[model samples]
Target: MHSSNLRLEEPIRMASILEPSKPNFFPAMTKIVGTLGPKSRTVEIISGCLNAGMSVARFDFSWGDTEFHQETLDNLKKAIKSMKKLCAVMLDTVGPELQVVNKSEHPISLQADTMVVLTPDQDKEASSNLLPINFHGLSKAVKKGDTIFIGQYLFTGNETTSVWLEVDEVKGEDVVCMIKNSATLSGQLYTFHVSQIHIDLPTLTDKDKEVIRTWGVRNSIDILSLSYTRHAEDIRHARDYLSKLDGLDQTQIFAKIENIEGLKHFDEILQEADGVILSRGTLGIDLPSEKVFLFQKAAIYKCNVAGKPVVVTRVVDSMADNLRPTRAEATDVANAVLDGCDAILLGAETLRGFYPVESISTVGRICSEAEKVFNQDLYFKKTSKHVGEEISHLESIASSAVRAAIVVKASVIICFTSSGRAARLIAKYRPTMPILSVVIPQLKTNQLRWTFTGAFEVQYLLCFSSCSWLPLPS
Candidate 1:
């Protein structure tokens, strides 16, 4: 997988990133991840978000094209330079989900209780308003009495509306579903399974692979969120693809748990991926609303035990209006932080929402407040544990540093190192003290952005005695 072209790019000279002191001031144990979209892609907006406490920038490829993503990457780099923040970038793949193919720009409205035919063809023109699907074996995979969700994707905006359908009949290539309710329609390749039928689909599409090879090979991303991950093998497959890319050694794989199959193989997938995302919107289609949040809690607990990055996503729904979050929404954010989720991801809220910055600030305020009352005994859980069992020097030092800080009641633990291994190990202990880690080679600093949950900051310090250098703006 190694590309010569990828290997040729000169490693960024360390001298350019050094600064006297740029404080990393996020004091909460949890981090905020804001997704980029049409609304939040500008350099000004992205820089504002990073300065306002957004630690990770997520780009979901499920909606945008390659050109759109490249623009986002460009803006994010500009923002990174503008804010002098080493924010991590997560490029999420579309994965294997079914969608609808609407050739017409106008949404052909369908009525309630109407009978419609579902075809798998994408290019075939529709007749009599028959909807076309992207999956070829759609009829074969479904049976009568099976539930089919006929969803509406608003083209004018990111808002989605959909109705349920019960499979009434199937004949050869056509599967007929009766609409349980009315819905507007406009989207691509839409489908969600209500049953336990997991199709044999490629983990990554051609487009997904292309992005990884191009952007990943070019060192444009920090992490890749593999979509629709059903098995641990899915994570392995994605990593297999990334292994060949040059300079992408730092790019980690994050598995997204959005379907029933993914949940079933949760532990295995969790261990395989760098982190996991509890995607509520997609999970809701498979499970009841109550069950979705319940699973989210359990998922968070499992990830904590494994010492991995676990994020609870799609929590704020009303932010689309740019209005203050409802009481329940506000409570949801606080609860997720209290539940030990390492991060809370804002989806449409930061993208299309009228108040993107306000939403980030709101979540930051809630998380900071929650961390103020966060009980270490309850959250970290003191159990009879093993220590110093074949631990590396860096790991051992991190543990000792954390203990020293706590014993002296030190407010901040400062560690100067070449790599971020010491900082990561300190984070694993869930220390009470803020970690101000000074690292070399800016890439390591960026990777460490997701390593610690507490008030952790990575300041790049490159001493180029052999070459001239300029410190970052004070």
Candidate 2:
């Protein structure tokens, strides 16, 4: 019997498959990473996301505790088991970001032009007149007349609840500021920005280390998205830390470019990181709003030439509240797909959004449509030219395979990869046909490890006999 018709009795773990021979196959080469939160933590929602084409489930450690994340992880596993779909799990660390904490369980309203004290003291509970920040050098970092903006405005562009303040005095550990605008403040993590000054902080925090040591190791996450990645050293530090752990040593590290410093050292960071995530939300705050798009294009192009996977987030942020994306947002998603990004990450749109499932479906639809117009041949030429003199053996094989596929008018390219490198190399050539990758089962769990690569689909075979192979069309 032919491999395409071959069937196995034993169960196998597989991700969503793309069949080029079938009319129903939705060929969206760009993957989707959906953030899991209160609104989308249930198995049903996760399953919906999976069916809608979510390739990864991301848990933001900035907001949830170990217990909460563990519950969500369990729910995700249940959904994967029930749906029999392989979805990679990612842990997004808090890094050295600053946030506000209050004594009141409820949000406090701050009136404009009122004086309030901002302290780094965790022991002090925030009141209507005082707010506590997570960082300790608040007083030393700010001087009189310096401006401070607090809220999620930078991240979500929702300025309705954000507060602006101007520093009036620095007293020991407390910085007194006069509120420039009226806004409601909550305990939710808020981005801190000071005008004309760089607040130096460690790349990874104590809480981040604790979370990785405790929750990350326990769950055996597939990816770690290091927030506020400033330099190559940060990536090395994270890799070093993970190397000490048993199962986590294999975890892929993705550096998130969020600030101006990160962008300044992006080349170094990219060389060290397994992948890169263009975090437009925080990047917008660090640079002019208009420049963000330019940076996005440049970063994506570089990652493509380097044969590294890059993910773009905050593409359809408006869909967090609305059922459908705006025309511009839709265009943005399409543009990202056209730019050759490996993945699009949905943060607020899925995390706390009212329409998580619809968001994923919408992005996936946009990507599929945009992919139709992608000039794959041109991209391939450009990528090959960029690799000029130093093409490796794997690159030559991958390039040849893609060329052969095109010349033969093949329906799909199926690659059996042990470390997923061959599949990634093939994907780097930008083949029009879908590439299906088969990986061996991991020894620890006796399950196929689904590492994030540019492959269109993946499957894990327990053994050689258990493989349900699919032959190339003749």
Candidate 3:
């Protein structure tokens, strides 16, 4: 019988639904990350996202300023208080990236087959004939006859607004290029792609370190998503920089696999980073668009075997404008869930989408349905076999707990966690039943540690010095 046609809901039970007191339980195992922007930064929208199943709130540091992010963070705290839900805040840094610097207030228009000068001078203002980029080594990096694609390459996959330029001549600190296509160039951070050319750029920019020291430290973000992670050294650098901060030592660093270099050294990067985010849109630009899906599947599978949380973004790009996603987008979300990704990150769908709430709800529903059809037993067997004979005591207990739950047809597996390690271990086995992780509030920072645990639901347990448990305040 087809797995989708088979109803697996009858055999397994949900303890939260059966009990009267646990009204706050969320059953969806797959977490949803909602990017906060102008459209969804308000308290009402954020609260709606939370109720609709947004587990993480992401702030894109590339666009907004420190003041704007602070306002958004303030609004997020208000929404969390109003909704009484725990949502993790993720700070996405603008890594070593190049962007067109347009000094004019309005967008500059370029004509097709027109000659233009590309310079690395930051002070130089961009015009119809001249364009400035953020990278200092722009001329040194690209040789004559190289192609540079600008606009609509990062985050958004809209190719209609993209401008293509072919390098004609390489002069001192300037590369003259002819615009292959006429497009309006907006002053936004765009992905600069030179086909098959690896631009030697630092993983972390000075701005990235400053953001970590200021905004990241101020807000106490739960996750620091390193953009364009090339290798393990990138993760280590970001981790080391974050450690130097006062309270950011525990901040989780998620390596974003966007370019070919990142994919080349993904295993080592994954070992160093706390989690991984597959940026399909950016990867599509770096590689052939056709191979993005293959890379996504491979990266997700590798992360699953490693027992690290993996997040897939750009699943529903069309949902930014439309209320309902395309049939292909729906299937894509379901496939990612079936692929065993721990979370699905909504980029434009939530950041500037017209229907943010509906998008979250739509993804949540798809995740819950897809999870029902997921082959947990087969997955567990494969994952366990990957561990082989060498296993830690925690892994043994976690594997046993999952096996015992399946044997007894348990409603839910309840585990008390201090550091959330044991809970994360059990979640790695991918049990059919939800794992409720109850964390004891020993340190205040421990509360945010459960953000990426992959647990179905997390609750805080109130305890006294006498070791007596009390019900969490409603």
- Per-residue CA lDDT of candidate 1, range 198-218, in tens? 766877788899888886566
Worst 10 residues of 1 by lDDT: 460-469
Candidate 1: lDDT of 291?
Answer: 88
TM-score, cand. 2: 0.85
lDDT (CA) per prediction: 0.68, 0.78, 0.78
Q: What is the TM-score of each candidate against the true structure?
A: 0.81, 0.85, 0.86
Model 1 C-alpha lDDT versus the unseen true structure:
0.68
Q: Go through the candidates in order and give the clash count of each.
A: 8, 0, 0
Where does candidate 2 clash, by residue pair?
none
Ordered list by lDDT, greatest first: 2, 3, 1
**Count of backbone collisions in candidate 2:** 0
Model 1 clashing residue pairs (backbone): 1-244, 98-189, 98-191, 99-189, 99-190, 100-188, 100-189, 100-190
**Candidate 1 regions off by >4 Å?**
1-27, 126-129, 150-160, 187-195, 382-404, 441-474
RMSD of each candidate relative to the true structure: 12.0, 9.5, 6.6
| Candidate 1 all-Cα RMSD | 12.0
